[model samples]
Target: MNTIKNHIGINIFSKAILMMVLLYSFMTVSARNLKVESPNGKISVQVFNENNTENAKWFLKVNYFNDGKMAETISSIDLGLILSDGISFTDMKLLKSSKPLLIKENYTMPHGKSLQRHNTGNEVVFTFENKEKKKLDVIIRVYNDGMAFRYSLSGKGNFTVQDELTSYSINQETTRWAEKWNPANEGLYSSMVGEKIQQEEWCYPTLFQTKDNNCWFLLHESAVDGSYCGSKLSNKEDKNKYKITFPDPKDGRGKGESLPKISLPWKSPWRVIIIGNLNDIVASTLVDDVAPPSVIKNTDWIKPGAVSWNYWSSNHGTKDFKTVCEFADLAVAMDWPYTLLDWEWDSMGNGGNLEDALKYIHSKGIKPLMWYNSGGEHTWVSSTPKDRMLTHENRVEEFTKLKKLGVAGVKVDFFESEKQDMIQYYLDILEDAAQFEMMVYFHGCLVPRGWAKTYPNLMTYEAVRGAEWYNNGPEFTATAPVHNTILPFTRNVVGSMDYTPVTFTNSQFPHLTSYGHELALSVVFESALQHFADRPEGYYELPDEPKKFMREVPTSWDETQLLQGFPGKDVVMARRKNNVWYVGGINGENIEKNINIKFDFLDKHNKYKLRLIKDGKHDKQLVTDDSVIESADSVDVKVLRRGGFAAVIFSIIN
Candidate 1:
């Protein structure tokens, strides 16, 4: 009987030991095993998804300083789960505990770029089961160095939903949420001391629904510096939202995937704040400082001052080269540099020949900058060689031929937006252009990303709401100054903007602003390749003073200053080129006010030539210029109604 009892005890002990061993094995397997080493620091990403759970969660912990210090933690809602009423929540809790969790999921970075392991955290995938029992996969990628964060929700869905959302709980009475989100990092929260914090709400979109329904969301916050700009692969429109959908329809279904769509209301792209300091010029300057130079080998191709003929010069008309050359002559005689041959100049069979146009433009001593669709076919061209178009394999070859043709530069159009691949495409084009010595102009694109420093060949990018709409109405001119004010604080910080300034004549187009406001744009807006987008007759019609000011105005500046203003309100900016300082100011609506102008940047011992442009009483649309000689100090000036001013300050040599 004793022996039998012993056998039973032994069996019980063995079972207990087995159970403990199993538990230990499961705990070990569930712990986080992946480690990311980044330039800024190291972080461990833990992903968790279970069959019984309603949602998937991701947790990021930094293993720096041997102890986690300065670690940031945030969570996102799983796109897989169906909200009770199809309503998605921006604020979702991330799973966390003293111990680690287990997660099993598969994902590929939407863009083809290789994923980097970083200390802040790397890409993570979360899966949620919707009410319909469909699995939705969401990707949360965190960049190192607090640049920004990107979240992509892609799966079988009725609509394609792409948004960048941020949620923060503030300490009430201790912090002001608005101040925290502004350009300045210091605010009520930084100044206050308290235990209980208030919950603050602030969220804005970076890029959304362009003319194409493919939506892109950019995170300009510190978490994801201006690194990734999202774009749609397909050009199809979302019938419900009237926007373009992502993931070209052709690529779906072949990879064991169903067509994915996003169906969430998104905010417009917000000015991303990647740096805490207002002087965060490093990223902005990198475009010029880091990118390779233009493909044109000889600086001789660049005339210091010449006018350009935008193929749009004819407004898609049958006007021959003779008529356009006349305009170029007007610019050359006036000392403006270079003329532009917008798109449709390449296909001689349809409109003009690339080689012939180049010869004519050079004969007139005006460098010619031709246009090319980065990817799409020109509407005017019928027999364009498919190989010459902007396809995956032929872009480099086409650009190489243009370089060989002695083309000064190329204006790339119809880029659309920042898809992961498209972002890389822009960089790729810049890299290739560098190899061939060609200058580049980007249109129908998002705001600049400081590529100017890296790729000096990238002369300009058209992201502004410029005078092109003047053909629409006067309201555009009026609203332009307001938009300009907002831009310097937001878009201009990224890089150069091609606002195609100085449309002196009313195209009788649908415009919202006055003609004088258009002229003022020449100085208020900054572009390396500033455009005079009006008939030469319009410029000649200006009074001698205004005309001389236009003739002497320089497009490129060595330094820039924001005197004062607000977005969608009023703005005043001063740019310096050579020895002259050109100041331009504008108001959104009709208003009279006096501003104190500071000449602090000028040498006190030097005298300056100040040429001021202000609205004329006889014609609100026309600007009158006044010239004066003044010593460096401060000047108080009175501006007219719905008016602004411009000044040229130069060292007067006696």
Candidate 2:
């Protein structure tokens, strides 16, 4: 009887152990399942498995939330996954009922077939097979400010698997959309807090929409100080030969990459966005977030004002101490804060005397801003460097000496592109300059990411299509409207842009547009250090109405408004600083239209004075109105062809 009881116990114990092993295996498999979560909620991705093959099909949904409740549903789009290689498409379709509401046509490579060589090594052809699909993992996170998604693929797969011989292949595609979801719907439009709010009409995905293959991984945002999307190539061989390519003529002239090369294995893990209540703060914050904190150690170094220059407009033409000082005197007379002495004045390579020029500029009661170059082989007009070149290590030494010379700021140029090392170089320059209580302005640089907020010492960046290129050709004139219209929605959201506003006449091009257009830009664009690209003489040539407006214009603002219009079409922006409100509007082509100006932002009880800069019907010159009138509630004005308008609204102090 005892032996029989022992045998029964042994059988029960063995069965229990077997069950435990089976449960462990099940839990391990479940743990690897794909999932996505945001601050608001969780989404469990359903992975369809059939005959050892796994696939996923779902519609990505995004909603804008305010105070923990969904304010509006932003976008929803159907997404699918299928196994495909260079030749064959997998017949296995899991979700046939769902279809893409919007289909983007094939993107045309900008540089034609020549750009193919640029992609030679960097191509990541992900092959999806049963083994790899089973090991796939994905995680996506969305925030009020931005969104990020990451994917990891593992396991083995056979490529070109014939009857006997086989090779391996691998690649993956991740896509998301913003705004557009309902195909029949025209999209959401509303006015919020007296600012005209235009949500994206089409689904504007950030990183994946470039027409240039070389820029396939580059991400862009609509808001100037918003987030960016980027991708890094995974393969080692592709990484080494990675070069960016632009679109060539074979692609339709208008249909190609608008930007430059964005290499992978990016120095920074992801693109950034700067969020704030106002445009300048939003842009400044982005730059501060991406830049090293050392660059802006003390906020006191950053001083706000309009600046006059010798760099871009003069192009190192005014190297003489007498001539440069005369320009500084003009800046002082205008009540402009600082004057910049561009390249060729530095003694290290260009062999010009910096001390005399610095003394002369300071004597005029004006602060001087000098220019410097990164470690490039050529120094100041094709001259070779005498010292081992101005690298990051020695950047501080140069900055300290400039500080001793009483220089308030430096405009560093010719960085070319934002490589990992170059990104580090910019950070180092900002940090080292901060130690000397010096401000910085980057030219030929990437768009601002909000560094100004963190390191207020960094004033502005030149990333827009400014008046400096009017000399290029008539085509530039046509391109300017589109570029300017697009920048505010995209780049301006990032930080203060040194667009060098208010060029009355193009010295190089004889046929210039309306002077009022230039005056409007001063108010339309936001920058900490507003650069008037024209010569002092040029400002004098401008009509008194526009010129006076330029003199009164302020660079930084406490509040901003997108009064009307869309990207690449038209734009009207207004900014508020203290008790005054400055408004600007631009029409792309030679079209006459009436724009309604709303006074809803102002306190109803207070009376205000209105000053206007509008286009002259017969003269093609800007007409000014010093005539003060009490605001009844709102103002409606008519603007002329290729024309713009500016207004200053001030409270009538009792």
lDDT of each: 0.47, 0.49
Per-residue lDDT of candidate 2, residues 27-145 (tens digit): 44434432232333321122223333233332333333333433212122222222224322232222111111221122111110010111000001122233232322223333323
Off by over 4 Å in 1: 1-307, 310-313, 317-319, 346-356, 376-389, 472-478, 508-516, 620-632
Report clashes for each candidate as comma-separated counts: 84, 32
Q: Model 1, range 303-421, lDDT digits (tens) per residue?
A: 22324544323564213555556666767766676777665554443444556666766777667676666554222233223224355457678777777766767777655434444
TM-score of each: 0.59, 0.64
lDDT of 2 at 564: 72
